[model samples]
Target: MPAEVDLKRYSKRFANLKSKKETPLTARIQIVGIGDDGLDGLTGQARQLIKNATVLVGPSLLLDKIGNTDSKRIVVGSNLQQLQQAIKELGDSSAVVLASGDPLFYGIARYLTETFGKDRFEVIPHVSSMQLAFARVKESWDDAYLTNLATQPLDRVVDNIRTAELVGLFTTESITPAVVAEALLDRRIDYFTGYVCENLGTPDETVTQGDLQSIRTQSFGSMNVMVLVRRHGAADRPSGSAQRRLFGNPDDLFLQSRPKRGLLTPSEVRCIALAELSLTPTSVVWDVGAGSGSLAIEAAAIANKGKVFAIEMDAEDFALMIENAKMFDVPSLVPIHGQAPEAWKELPDANAIFVGGSGRIVPELVSSAIKRLTSGGRIVVNVSSPDNLVAVQQVLGDAAMQPDVRMINIARGQYQLDRVRFASLNPTFLVLGQK
Candidate 1:
């Protein structure tokens, strides 16, 4: 018995030493893209590869769908480390990894190929679920914004969806069609016709369609894709329902009681001022001396995810500004019915500042607001008189690339007896300072 035990110990030591000296596995992995239809959906070549595989690795759901395979199978889950360790341990074993839809389209193929050598694997792709969803909806997806809910936060995704003509989303278990529908409705984005496609390519497959309000109340199967199609002639904003003009909306769209008319910024100047602000989607803007909130309202629309504070002392203009914001469905615009320099004391620092006034105080207000602007922030001021313009430019300082100054002289087109005439507007000076 003692002699037999010694012989076994010697044999184990020899095997261990041999394993340490041997090279790592060079076996190639076959990654097959399969649909919900399982093996029935795979091509003949893919089926043969799986049949010949010595080891198979995939999600348990996919593995179950491809049941009774003669190959040794390893189930992959959320644990990426486990998957990598399993592959490393499968030395000299030819393996096949199955994934859903197009393997490279937000699937396991990209991860696997990155972890292992790309040259060590072969990929066979099927139609992606996102493609299938758009196809089922009969929509062209060339320019459509596509995102995966599993990867991106729904809040940030909703902002992009606001302006997107078409959006295709891959739904996750926690963030489902119902959650997305509710989010859209909450943002007052009601123009899209929502589609929920579930269990695609399977016998129990279903495609559900409804408006945002209707879809908000519904549930869906775990495996699904949600698509949103913005209706024809729909503006990129809910405010478009009331104020449909793209950028420099007409001043008449705003409610300026009796004598306050013509106090709002002209469409031409509004466009110029907005462009100079260099605003992003989440830029915080301050429109001081905001009469009827024309520039502030438009800025709020452009910075969809940002906040805009419209500071006006006039009660009538302040009320008008509030009404105009709601009229344009601009939920991000906050009407501050007090004077500036003090009204903005408690508000957050701004990214872009817009000061509009014909008086001397306009330049000083712009100067004070500039102090509150964040680094790399922008400030644009529109002064009607030449003195205020020069004073504003002086406060902005004269760096080589510092301030941008422009004189805006606009004219309105009019027709009299089929003859065209132009009505000239007073010359206004604009100074844009970047800090």
Candidate 2:
């Protein structure tokens, strides 16, 4: 009896020693991405992590892999608010969350980290469905225009795809391949071949390839990415040779007001304003006196996810800006209908500023806009008359340094019986200032 008691104590002491030598473990949230193949396809580390988890949280499709649901589990569906509540209530419990592909790549990792902080969790990722689709098609996706159709508007996604060699999209209940194909065809963008990769990484995975017009006629599964490769010499080699054009695209392409014709801020002026703005992909811009929102719309396109406020005093021009934004497929333009200075009061500090029109209120507007601009923000003003141009230059020069001003005169070629005539547009002055 005494010998047995001594052996038990010795065993307990050895167990404590072994635990102390091993790495420390804690209660944490593990976000894992799984493919369609299910359990048999999970990595060894992923499998062990799931089996040892005290609490599991995921969608129904992922929950099926556990084989036993007796453990404390939370089923997540489309309710992000509910998911957040569930996670918050989990307090002190070790949690294992299941997601669809790489959690960090448009998955739950961002939300979890944002809500619970990065130190509170660990991520175990699987092959992303997009990666699998690209693999199935035997193509590298390093430069592919990738975005989730679930979160982005159809027009924005289509516009981004318009200029890309390949596109990978995470689709949802509404935006499918047929719908996407129809959109591209409607835009007269029929110069490319299309491919749809569906149910990738699973046994029933399939890849379908056809021209944009041909693909429009067929239907595809829910999980898919519409890939496009431009055909040889498709339409006029796209405006410029990728070096980035400084000015003058087709005027009809922009959103312009009806009765008040030629209200669009010309492309030349727009380029100069953008240059003065010194825009980055994330700079927030405010286009005061935004006529037809030409400057604001282009600024939004250049600043991708950044925000742009298109403040216009005219109702007709405001509506036209909305139409133009939809046509350009730029999502960052926020159209605000009101007079400047007063309208800009509620907006966040702007990184760049653009003021247009030859109105007498130019000086006051410039002063008000400068106050709201962040440090080092650039401002550009456009004027049509020499008088207004001189006024703007004086105002800007007094507030900051010697302003850089330019006179822009553009002429388009028109075909005649035996020659080309120079059809001239309006001449304008662009004044750039900084604070």
Candidate 3:
């Protein structure tokens, strides 16, 4: 039969079938995932769903690749609202949405599930292109940071990539692999090996590997995934975000209320406190009494992959910490407004903890936090008074191994009209213990 004749016959058959069926059929939606293998790769269930679908919706590439199924096809254009309207018009007809790879991982299924309820979709997920990209690069992506350029912009994704060991990105034609390489080099991040995997799961699949400078001029196909593997022994970024320090950032650089500025942990003390905790790239940390979030923000930067909870009871301090965290551009820092012991009830066990305060209750907070620390976990406490020092030391020393104690006395330089002056901050005591 001629191709046009077959299409006409199928359309007539579909019209007659629709007339016979009841109006508004409550058919289940089949969100099917396909790869480069096309229809041959689909499971028996997925194949049947696509074959019997009353209506089909998907990207143009997928529709072209799937060939002819004779179903009422609707191309999902760049405008998602149009697709939503089409699906709404379909009523409850069988909708077999053709998608590539696992639709849930940065795919169309998220939007569909959101637009229509989850109960409407029966998603058949396939091997994600991200997984294939990592497998081709022979890297473990369990700890790798994964994101998509189609939804998330480069700036937001790049910040999270600073401290990541491995990064897998879904690249678009406009924001190609080369664009990402240039962005990384522009930020002075030169310690990663970039790989571009194109036409994944197909016979023409290719993986290109190079440094940022080498990949800067290359253009890749529209369908590609970019992977970045950080070179061993390389720091997250050279100077910690253009002008800020990775940790122990100056107290004044943070956004703080005038009266609480003096109460916040000093840069000198934070430096020592951070060093005592012995942070790693993926360590769960907690900052009790996280005033202005100075300590919590630094911890979040160091442990970018891990979670950091800044537990502060004071409403003013909690609010200040949130603002300061944003100022520092640390996304992993979570501000908890409630008091500790209770606030930390639902939090994960901490690999490192920092407690800052000079009140008599500092000892009690330290004791409670120590109880929640993981084995071999370290805790650092900073106090300004002898009474707090003695009390915290006693409490920590009793619950942990013998504590390491230090007294930090800091001074800053000042020059006015060819004259030099030295200003001194109040002395503080740092007590560190390992559980």
Candidate 4:
């Protein structure tokens, strides 16, 4: 019994020693997130850390808010390299680096941690101004696209805002809320309700709510966070430029049902399908299973003098298709809200047909659709599964159409954490046949 007790004790001691060696010690350099309200906004622990800090580092504005601290101060400026050197000179001294809002959220902590490994510094975050802005407007930000105008360009930011359902931006002195609002209006993106929260967490805090047009003309304080919430059921407007392309518009430009977003034919696939159709200026085109009218609208733009029918079965998707067609301003595009074969009974014979969907009945739909294709006209079928690919090929073969098959594999490049990553779309197969 005594031997067993001794063995357990020894094992416990060894485990403790192993854990100590494995666990990294808390860093001496503390990066604390502070607000405009300064010391009063800090937690007790954060306040004590600042009070006991041997050296303090922050912007001149933030250092001014520290009042009379005995700790040595180093002011941060545009040159971050100098700040890094100052922090490095502190060596073994206990130092506190102050930042605005959450230190890790587009703040200096990322730079500091990258310069001198994460193990050398501990970060304590406060409520971000962006969070306060959303809270003031009573909106949830978990899914909001948050960015900083200080770090990213305004044009790129406005482009991203075009498709986002919700957006939060940290407005800089130069790129204030009014400036951002103006830029958005310049792009004709006026669907969102804008809110500018200024001097958050301070006595002089103000929250201004208005439309993008009103916000554009109004002046705001330098310190502000802008929040934009897209209006419900509002379709994104097409680009206001007259130089817009006739065909192959970007997939995002169309309004698709949220749950059925991926149902729309990708731009690359749509371009290939449209090309295969060999549409004439006055060709009658049918886009069967057109979820959001992406292909139908583009076809209408190409066949300006002709008619394009977008047939969709789902009621919600049909409504979305109508909205999308209007947004694209394709007057020649007509939406038919019913299943195939029956839907096209009253319609004219099509010069070109594009069949797109992943249903098991796609083979049957394609077979029926080809019957409506005029002699010497083209038909293109887009399918994702190999089974459907073979089935469609067989149907075309039975009609002696001699289908030409092509598989499309696309990978779009995405920028993440200063690196380019490729996100691949599911491979799609296009089977083209001419009557």
Q: Which candidate wins on TM-score? A: 4
Clash totals for all candidate models: 0, 0, 0, 0
- Those runs of model 1 whose alpha carbons end farther than 4 Å from true positions after fitting are 1-25, 238-435
- By TM-score, the better pick of 2 and 4 is 4
Candidate 2 lands at a TM-score of 0.52
**Listing every candidate in turn, what is its Cα RMSD in Å to the true structure after a full C-alpha superposition?**
17.0, 18.1, 19.1, 6.4
Highest lDDT: which candidate?
4
lDDT score for residue 361 of model 2: 89
Residue-wise lDDT of candidate 3 within 1-435, one digit each (tens)?
Answer: 654567888999999997895665466788999987678777888888888898889888888877788799998876879878877887777788888999888777888998888988889987889999999999998878787787776886776566567899988878988999888888667889999999888888999999999998988888799999988756334233447889978665665553344787888888888989999988999998887788899999999988899988887667767767876778788889888778899999999999888778889989888889999999999888989888887897688478778998889774321235777999989988998
Lowest summed lDDT across 10 adjacent residues in model 4 is found at 235-244
lDDT of 1 at 399: 36
Ranking by lDDT: 4, 1, 3, 2
Clashing residue pairs, backbone N/CA/C < 3 A, model 4: none
Give the distance in Å from residue 308's predicted Cα in candidate 1 to where it truly belongs: 17
Give one digit per residue, the lDDT tens place, for model 1 in 1-435. 454567788999999998786665587888899899999988899989988999999889988988797899898886889888887887778888888999888887778888887987899998888888888999999988788887777876887687677899988989989899888887677889999999898898899999988888988999899999888755333322343665788654566554345667988999999999998889999999898788999899988899988899998778777877887788888889888789999999999999999887876787788889998998898988889988888888833226779999999874322235787988898898888
Could you give candidate 2's per-residue lDDT for residues 182-266 as a string of tens digits? 8877766676777788877777878898887778788887766666666653431122122332234445465444335565776
- Computed on alpha carbons, the lDDT of every model, listed in order, comes to 0.83, 0.76, 0.82, 0.87
